[model samples]
Target chain A: MSTIALPHQERGASFWRLVELVGCYVLGLLWIMPLLYAVWMAIHPPEYEVRFDLFAPLTLDNFIAAWSAAPFARYFFNTFVLISVILVAQFVICTLAAYAFARYEFKGKTVIFMLILLQLMVMPEVLLVENYRTMVRLGLVDTVLAMGLPYMASAFGIFLLRQAFLTVPKELDDAARVEGAGSVGVLLRVYVPLARPVYVAYGLVSVSYHWNNLLWPLVITNSVSTRPLTVGLQVFASPDQGVQWSIISAAALMTSAPLLIAFLLFQRQFVQSFMRAGIK
Target chain B: MSKLSRLQSQATPWLLLLPAAVLLATFTHIPAVTTFINSFYTTPRGARPARFVGVEQYQSMLADPVFLAALKNNAIYALGTVPLAIGLSLLMAIIVNSSIRGRALLRMSFFLPTVLPMIAVANIWLFFYTPGYGLFDQILANFGFSSTNWLGSPNTALPSLMLLGIWKEAGFFMIFYLAALQQISPSLAEAAALEGASRWYYFRRIVFPLLMPTTLFVLVNALINSFRLIDHVIVMTRGGPDNASTLLLYYIYNTAFRFWDTAYASALTMVLLAALAAFSFIQFGILDRKVHYK
Candidate 1:
């Protein structure tokens, strides 16, 4: 209803606009207030102490302390490696699976698809004990590869990518076949690029989710080298050392920086993907 | 469908499916079997070799006070977090749906909490709930309201965590509503408006009906999340305040890691799977109803 707003008086629009802007500022500040406080605490020393003193100097002391508190670099690297390995593995596996389900008509299709969707409901974390035993049996405890293996074939990703692939015209596949391409070539050439947005959307959602996930990683990874940032951040955050609030906040800010920055940068896309993720 | 032509016609699809099937079977299916098996076993420590005990773990787990407390807390936590988050998000979506200026900014601000790591937000909320110099306390003190032990009080701990859960998840649920809002034709609203219908009336009849499917989806996710989410408890409460915040998954975590009783933990996991199965059944039923209603 463009008409609903258009014929309205300029006064009404201006009043609402002013209200909206004020609301935006207040809500935005409220939303990001914790992170801002973390920045303040992380940069300032303990003596400053919540005194509303804006003029206090900043330093790298908290960062350095937080850095030395654990294998922050290795944790960061592990998280990066874990995301990459899982993303690539999930993309390839889910792509093929999605292609088959999207393009082929076969017996047990509904049954198999239903089973795959069951994983979405029974999230692996809920079955942690059994999965842990499996990992131990495979002698993959405390390894990044083990951390990534369970998620190598994601039901959610397959569902999303299959929905994407199904949107491609069958005429394109026929043309590709006419042009001397096999089924594999048709998938690579015709479907993948057309589904680039879905890939980006799925990839962003996956990376952000796995980046923030802690439970599964905690169950699987014991050593520092395999520990992701979220789990490591916990070791700093979950201590009985009388609660070093500032340093802990500092570590948390560091841990969440990547996903937060990505959200800030691609706010619209992030929101859109989240909407898609929700609906699916 | 084609045993004779299976080698020729069925080769490609099965080939494509091999990797995913293998992984899902190994990781998901195999663990399912282990879950069924382990629930029947007894192990002294997680390190010790286990022996079959035939539902002894389940029987003991049922009688265990700690397990009962955890289940109670989980019920309250689930009941608390899901409804409030969905309700608030629906409200937020309605507000954003208005031709409000700076809607994009407000939307982004609302969604900021979802992007932060659960532990990070839990840590921040933990500090805010901390006794003194905390945000909640500081604001309360300034307003002449003496600070309450938000997370420390047994009565308040689960609610406090539920509050955090709502704050973190409402924006997430909002996006889904927003998307659904976009798809509702403006003409429908206009036609109702032309009938001299009040905004409330129009929304009651038109918008709510249109949003039924999205609501179902949100509800399913919220239910799943109440069980699936363990990170927040690990950071925020550690199932504390006399086990007031103890959730099912968090209890399983304690059984496996803290108590070091792998058999009991496996039994606890089976309970979680049962909860999840119930949730899935409800979700599917709701989805079917929504489709029929639509």
Candidate 2:
């Protein structure tokens, strides 16, 4: 197999490979053009936004302007609280539910699991009208809690953790039980530690999702005190804000900086975890 | 084991599941039911309690021009975004999966858009679509072409949105494809090359069939995304240029919040829910086929 097509085929393949590589590179450039363009507009002064100058003066005034223009400090704090609460709640809730589903022989388990998976298809955002009504009824509207409430019991997290747990050796569970560990202790010790990679994967997915999620957050939060960065950026960048491209670009970048920086810093883990999450 | 211990075991699982079950019921199951129920009623106004109308909204939806336009636009939107996203993502996966130079940078570039919020992306693209002052016009003017209003014109509004959809989504689907590609054994490719099969031919025949399951998974996600993704529409177009870009979810949003027509929004949501249900059914069918393959 190696020698039969070694000489001529190798040359031809390498030629085509070169073409393909160049094609991929061009597409890659086009793919990130928006981000590049945004960064260019953001770091430079407004006069140089459309100007193509190699030695253009750069400034951080746009960031300062964008920050002071909105209550971004409050918005960042709101988003921080929102995602942290949701992540902790999801980890706890999904861990318990997944432990039950993975280890137990309970009645109607399959039925309940199916019901939970329905959320994957019809997310709370899809039922925004009713969910908002529910939030209002519960008197939690316009709060950070409202933004994260629907996502507290995440089906994806439960499913992913359940799959991870099911792969754990039975001997490990029996050993943990033999040590007189309660269900919660066994879960915390055996299942959670064993599923550390899955946790990281789910965590990355969840944080990024809630961070980037706009529609439900946009609909639910009415006050600046509770609005997350996505909603704040939306309000800041809306048509009535009078189209300061550099300022809008700065605001957009500022809101997305944490996740973007984390992604770059942990590029391999981010890609691998996203790949891991997608596999199932 | 004693009877008490057996009983404890029985209660334990339920106890473990209690919190999740309650939260899920509160946010998901109950609201879903309420959305369905509200679809059959009229919106309550000041000094007016809600009245049961029994599918009147659905009947009216059939005659509503905006609803029809949104429905038609969403269909076209789905048709446009899904196949293109799938294809481009597959191409991207194949490129990155190979022993290509600068794979990390390329992969990062491909996936960068997925991390940014859709609203932010729309804000940036909104600038790009600005007439005579935007990226597209600036580039086209280099070729002596006159500036055109991309989003402000009806004919181009939906397509412009579709282009953004494809760009935003292709990288996401690429991750799944890349995962699938990594799982493919290398021996088959060696055998194909030994048999003198061209790269394109090998991809079309051998690789594509092997990727059918991933394709189906990405397809379902893409279909669902077409209905659910209205963030860009909200930020960029707002269903502008005479409702040319009004997606179903966006319309439902406007009906519910802007107009305070909760009942009508519920009815619209029911339609979206029904469509999602249909997509899930397709997913089940695909899952069954995948099982059969295994």
Candidate 3:
């Protein structure tokens, strides 16, 4: 097989390979064009936003202007508190439920698991109207808690942790039991340590998701005190603001920078874990 | 061994599951049922208490032009995005998976959009599509073409949004394809090469069929995404100059919040829920068959 391909590779394959390479490079440039544009527009003065010049003077005026145009500090603080609460709650709730599903057998177990899985397809966002009413009824409307409650019991987290827990060797459970360690102790010491990678992967996904999520937050929180960055950016970028491209781009980059920087720094782990997390 | 211990074990699972089960019931299941029930009631107005009006909201939704347009637009948006995005991502995966120079940079560029928020991407694209002096128009003018209203025009608005959808999602789908591609043994490619099969022929006969499971998984996700990924629509067009890009979920949002028509929004949500349920059924059926095959 190697011999046959060697001759062909010397014949027409190089040309085609070259074409494929060039094609990929072009596509790559096209893919990253928006980000490049954002950087260019964001750093340059408003006049040079649409103009491309290698010698154009760059400034931080856009960022300074965008910062003052909205209460971004409050928005960032709201988003920070929102994602932290949600991630913590998800960890606790999903760990317990996943441990049960992975290790225990009880009546109606299958039925309960199926019910939990149903949320995978029928996400809370689908029933936003009713969820809003539920929030209002609880007097949680316009609060950051309202933004995070629906996502506290995450189906994806439970499923991922359950898979992770199932992979822990039964011998470890028995050894822990022989040492007179309770089930909770076994889970905390053994299973949790074993599932650290899964936890990191799930945590990254959850943080990025809630950070970028806009629609539900927009619908749930109307006050500046509770609005996340995405909603804040949306309000900032409204067309009625007369298309301040430079300032808008600055705000956009500012809001997305944390995730983008983390992704760039942890590219391999981010991609690998996303794959390992079996999002597909 | 003892009856008491057996009883304790029996209660353990349920006790552990209590918090999750309660939260899920409170948020997901209960809200879903309420959404269904609320769809059958009229929106309560000042000095006018809510009353049951079975199927009236649904009837109005049927008669409502905006709802109909949104439904049609969403269907078109899904049809446009799902296949194109899948195909583009597959191509991207194949390209990156092969022995190409600068593959790391290429893969990073492809995956970059997935990291950025839709609102940010929409803002950048808004500048690109801006009339007269936008990046696109500036480039087009270099070729003596007139500037066009990419997002403002009805004919191009939905497609413009679709383009953003594809750009934002194809890289995400590419990661999945890349994972699948890496799993395929290289020996098959050697065998295909021994048979003197061309690259296209090998991909068509060997690579694609081997990727069916991944394709199915990606297809379900893409379908769900078509409904969920209206963030760009909100940021870019806000469903457009004439609701040309109004998707079902976005329409539900407007109906409920902007108009304060909760009952009508619930009715719209019921339709969205029904669509999701159908997709889930299809997914589970396919997944079950795949499991059986395994």
Task: Order the candidates by DockQ, highest first.
Answer: 3, 2, 1
For all predictions, the C-alpha RMSD in Å is 3.0, 2.1, 2.2
Candidate 2 lDDT over residue span A21-69, tens digit each:
6788999999999999999999999998789898999899999999999
Query: What iRMS does model 2 reach?
Result: 3.2
The regions of model 1 sitting more than 4 angstroms off are A1-29, B1-6, B44-49, B290-294
Q: How high is the lDDT of residue B15 in model 2? A: 95
Q: Count the clashes in each prediction.
A: 0, 0, 0
lDDT of 1 by residue, B1-294 (tens): 578766656778888999999999888877887878877988755476777789798889879998999998888888988998898788677666677666676787778888888988888778888877788889889889887888888988898888888888888899999889888888877787667775567777778877888888888889989988978788877888788889999999888877778888888888888888888888777565645335
Cα lDDT of model 3 by residue, B1-294, tens digit = 899988887888888899999999999999898889989999999999889999999998889999999999999999999999999999888878876678788899999899888988998898888888888899999999998999999998999899999999999999888888888788888877778877667777777877888888888889988998789888888897799989999999988889999988988999999988888877787564763212
lDDT of 3 at B14: 86
Give residue B115's error in model 3 in angstroms.
0.8
Q: Rank the candidates by TM-score, best first.
A: 2, 3, 1
Native-to-model Cα distance after best TM-score fit, residue B203 in candidate 3, in Å: 1.5
Question: Residue B241: error of model 1 in Å?
Answer: 2.4
Docking outcome class, model 2:
medium
